[model samples]
Target: MSPSLSIATTVSPASLAGTLVSNSKNVLCSLHWKNNDATKTNRNLKFRVCSVSGGYNTSVENVPFPRDYVELISQAKEAVELAMKDEKQLMEIEFPTSGLASVPGDGEGATEMTGSINMIREFCDRLLAPEKARTTRIFFPEANEVKFAQNTVFGGTYFKLDYLTKPSLFEDFGFFERVKMADRVKPEDELFLVAYPYFNVNEMLVVEELYKEAVVNTERKLIIFNGELDRIRSGYYPKFFYPKLAALTKTLLPKMETVYYIHNFKGQKGGVLFRCYPGPWQVLRRTRNKYICVHQQESMPSLKEVALDILASA
Candidate 1:
C-alpha cells in the first residue's frame, strides 16, 4: 500500500488555519528571547569541551565514539542522552549513513535520508528512558516515509511515526499538503524527534514552525535527527532560491545545540569532522585502527576548509 493513499488523509485549508491560529496565539504570548550567553552555555552540557594539547590522545580505541554502523548508533544515542541531561530544548544529532567515507550532502551519501529510519528507531529506543519512550513522537518527511519506516525499520509501529508533509497530486511539482504543528502534537507528548526532514526544503520550515508553535514555550523538547542541515549551512541551497531554508542558518539553527555530529571528507587530505555535546569540534585523521586529532576548535569548521586547508596542511 502506498503511504499517500494508506496513511494520509485530506486536510482542508480552513481546518488547518483554525488549528494553526489557535496554537499561534498561544506561542506568541510566550515568545521571548533568552539571553544569548545563557542559550549557548547555560546548559552546562555533560561533555566537557576543553582545550586539547598537541599530544592529546586521539586513538580510536580510546575515543568514546564508534566506527561501525551499530556502534555509531550507540554513540549517537549517548550523545543525545548527554544533551537530554542539559537544559537545551532544541538539539540535533547528525552523521553519515555511508560509514563516514563521505559528507552527508544531498545526492552523495548512501541513501542517508532513507537509511536514517532504523538508526532513529534504534537510538531513540536506547536513548529514551523507559517512562519517556512512549511520550516521544517521531516525525518524518512525508506520510509515505512514515509508512515505509513502520513496515521496515520499526518492524510494526514501535513508536509514533508521524509526518511533516502530505503528498498532493502536484507533489512532483513541489507541492504538498503541510500538516499543522498544533494538529500533530498531543498534550501527552513530551518530546518531538523529526527524522531526516531535509527531503523537501519546506519540510525544514515546517520544523521551525513546529518549534515555534508547539515546543517553544512548553516543557517539550525537540530533536532534529539527521536533517542534513549542513546543506543550508554550506549554501548548497542558495539563499535566493530557498530564502526560508537559508534563513534557518541564522534563525532556527542558531537556537539548536548540535548534540552530536560527524561529517567526512574523502581525498588525499581526507579527515573526519566530529563533535559531541560539550566537546570541541575536532578534525581527525584515521591511523590504522585509531584516529589522531590534528586540529580542534570551539566552533565548527567548514567542511571545505577542513578538507582543503586544515587537513591539507596537517
Candidate 2:
C-alpha cells in the first residue's frame, strides 16, 4: 500500500514494450500493443496489467482485455475496496481465547487476525509470480467459499475441489481420478500450493495418495496451508488416524525434498510455518520431529517470510 513499494501507471497503446505497471491494488490500468510477426499479419493486443514489486521483480502476462475495459476496471477497483473493508473487519474480530485455553497449551494471548490475512496475500503474490506461473499449481479444496476479489490476485489454474460436502469421493479412488482428469500436471512442475483445512486427520489417506501422485508425477515442493490446527488439538481429530498418518509421511519422506506443515498453533493467536521432514523413528514416534519454525511473529508470520523460508530451505 506504500508508494515506495509500488506505483501504478497508465500507458498508451504504443508503449506496452517499455511501460511498467507497479504492483498496487488502487492502480487499474490497461495497455495496447501490436504483436508484429513477419510470418503473420500484425495484430494489436490489449492487456490489463497489475505489476507487483518485492524482492523478486516480475510482470504479469498480457491478458486480452474485454471491450468493456472501463467497466471491468471499475469492478476491479470496487472489489479491492470491499476486500480492504472486510480485512478491517477481520482485524476487529477478537480471538476466542477462552475456547483455546481448554486445549493443552499455556495461557491466552491476543493477535491481530490481520496478520494471517496479510500472510496469505503475500503468499499468493509470491506464488503468482510469472517465473512460478509455469511450475506452480494451487489447489483449493473448498472453492465456493473463495471470493472473486482474492481470485483476481492469484491468477492461475487453481484446482478447486468440493471435497468437504462430498467426502465419499476422497475415501476411494475418485479423488485421484478427479485430480488426474482435471489437471494434467507435468513432471517438471516444481511447486504445489494446497489450501485445505484439517489436513492431518480425516483426509490423511487421501492426502498421502495425493502426495504420492505429486512425487511420482512431478518431483515438486508441496506446501499445505491449514487454518484449523486449534480444532485438531481440541480432541476433534481422530486419535487412531494420527499414527497411521505419521507412518505414511515417514515412509514418503525420503522422496519428498521438503514437507512444510504450516498451521495455526493451539492456544496461540498467530500461526507458525515450519519445515517438517520425516526421520528418526524415535523422534517421529515421540514428538514427530521438532518442526523448524521458519517464520514466527506477534501474530501470524507474513507470507513473504514463508516464501523466503521455502526458498532458503530448498
Whole-model Cα lDDT of every candidate shown, in order: 0.69, 0.34
Candidate 2 per-residue C-alpha lDDT over 86-138 given as tens digits, one digit per residue, 9 for 90 to 100: 33111011111222112222222212222333334444443345565556554
Model 1 misplaced regions, further than 4 Å: 1-65, 105-110
Assess candidate 1 and give its TM-score to the true structure: 0.77
Number of clashes found in candidate 2 = 1
User: What lDDT tens digits, residue by residue, belong to model 1 across residues 95-136?
Assistant: 877665655554453377666876887777667776776788
lDDT of 1 at 53: 24
lDDT of 2 at 6: 39
Deviation in Å, model 1, residue 232 alpha carbon: 0.4
Question: How high is each candidate's TM-score?
Answer: 0.77, 0.35
